[model samples]
Target: MDRRNIQVGDYMAVTSKLPNLVSSTTAIYNNTNCSEIMKTGNPKVEIFLITLLTCVFIFGTIFNSLAVWVFCFKMKKWTETRVFMMSLLFSDCCLLFTLPFRIYTTQHPWPLGDSWCNALLSVYFMNTYMGIAVITLISMDRYVAIKFPIKARTLRSPKKAALACGIIWLVYISIRLYLALGAKWRNGESCFRKDTVMPLKRALYFTVFGSCLPMVILIFCSTQIILTLKKKEKTSMNEEKDIKKSISIVKTNLAIFLFCFLPFSTGNIVRFVIESIGSDCSLIKLINDIYYAAQGLSDLNCCLDSICYYFVAKEFWEKASLFPRFKKQLIKDQTQESSI
Candidate 1:
């Protein structure tokens, strides 16, 4: 496009334009069309969201930050997994840092103004796509390690992983921010809603490419890994143990992301589809409740990330300094007591 057109596009992207004082025009319409759609999200769900987000903030911060430290400071040689892990750590922490803002929004209006609200909401969107891409990469990398060890030795490297990670982050933000910046931001509306101007197709394109595609690829890689392990089951005892461990890891990773993604994505997409196709008040209200609950569950991925990303380290707690020392000291005390 021409510079003039580009300038216009950029201007439209960040413009503040919303309908009123409550989240988005769509939310207003929901309440208008649906019966008490705004009240569909029960009090317990709100309370649960607040509690869950707070826990994610505490644990995700501790674990993701610790992983970043270990990958950057403690490790001398950067492996492919370390590079990917570090990227995932950064992404997790990025979203985790914004949890306090998100938590407040669940209970109160956006007290921080449009800029903070938009920026924080954008961060959450960026996290979902960037994280899904990175997690898929990690899963494929592990599959390569076990299935084709020699090939992995040649193809898998820190530099390549870092390069791939950079691309994922860049592409995701470029796409997501196009939606965020170009979005109509009103004073009283929440930042997460779709504007009338922003077509539903845009959201679908993002979901298909960013979320669905990555998920499909991840499932494929996980399946291949599991099959290969079973095929080679008669390998040495250590190899058998590793195979079981790898299978467990894949299962856990799949469960965490899929569990989070399925609920929110289903509800969110269905709600939009219903809105686009034909307005059904009861359906909209029901889906709204589902969306809110699932959205809260999806946020738990910030915590689940720590389990799949950080604990996968084979070196374990050697450099963690957070776990082993406590265990070792406790064991020492137990030995002393027994001897006495």
Candidate 2:
């Protein structure tokens, strides 16, 4: 048998070695909280994770880059949704920047050195939480816009949205800054450092704030938005468009939470519990595999968000349509002038 050390979350790992436990039925413990290093080396896991991260990084970068350009240049009118999405786009880019290092680390040593590794990991973790925050805020914004369109005007302003995003970035950077400075370093599969005891607890605390709490807020806002939409009938074209946009935003954010995010987040919590219970190494292996897979799925949110948040927005595609229309008109005019 092979000995594998799995660190779930930050430092939730087996510090002790588990070898040939299959033959023994007797329970054994050096300490109730004794950390053991369980042997788990899965090349297939690294391959799959790298593949997923690569795809997400490529597509996410392109889509989000275009979104940023459009929001900054072409899309003039600023709505709460647009402002929130711009913030999300920046967060996605930060995550995207970390993927190349992650993929590189899958096959090679950490080339950028320990200091850069720490910085990169901080960027990765920080942006992930930042996205969670922005998504939760957008969900609430949409709910208010739909439920109380008139009253929401005061609540939904570009200035206020920018302020919220500023706060999110500021707070997130502060927390991650501390982690990067303090986290222990080593080369690993994901390019993130292995967690020790203190770091693992910190990771858990961050996860609760970043994923768990935001998830609750998203679920509530989504429910309210859906109910409000269902209650009111779309009497006009504008209302129909409003309804569609709201639904798109809701479903997109919900999909990110329920599908991409929820799995890994659930895995993180479960793995922590099982590790504390001192389960079989084989069982631990299974949980570790699930956690890795869930992590890949969570990364998929960057790609999927482009569809739900950017492409689905009429303003985005509509403005993009203008270039083609303008080109066609120019061609038509030149042909007529040449013929004359």
lDDT of each: 0.70, 0.70
Residue-wise lDDT of candidate 2 within 1-340, one digit each (tens)? 1233333422343323234352242344432122243323468887898889989988988888777777788888987667888888888888988888877766565566677887887888788888888888877776777678889768879899999999889998887777767765553332553322212566577778789999999999898887777677778876666666556556665876789889878888877777766676666667776787788888888888776554335566555544775755544322110000
Model 2 residue 40 CA deviation (Å) reads 4.8
Candidate 1 local lDDT, 1-340, one digit each (tens): 6999999987776564433434677776765645334433457777988888888788877777677777788777777767887888788888887888778767565566777777877788788778888888988887777678779778878898999999888887787678767874443444453323222676567677877888898899888878887787465775566566667777888989899887766766777787676566666556665677787787788788767643466543455556664856543322110000
Off by over 4 Å in 1: 1-41, 185-187, 193-199, 322-340
**Candidate number with greatest TM-score:** 1
lDDT of model number 1: 0.70
Backbone clash total, candidate 1: 4
Model 1 root-mean-square deviation:
12.2
Model 2 scores what on Cα lDDT? Answer: 0.70
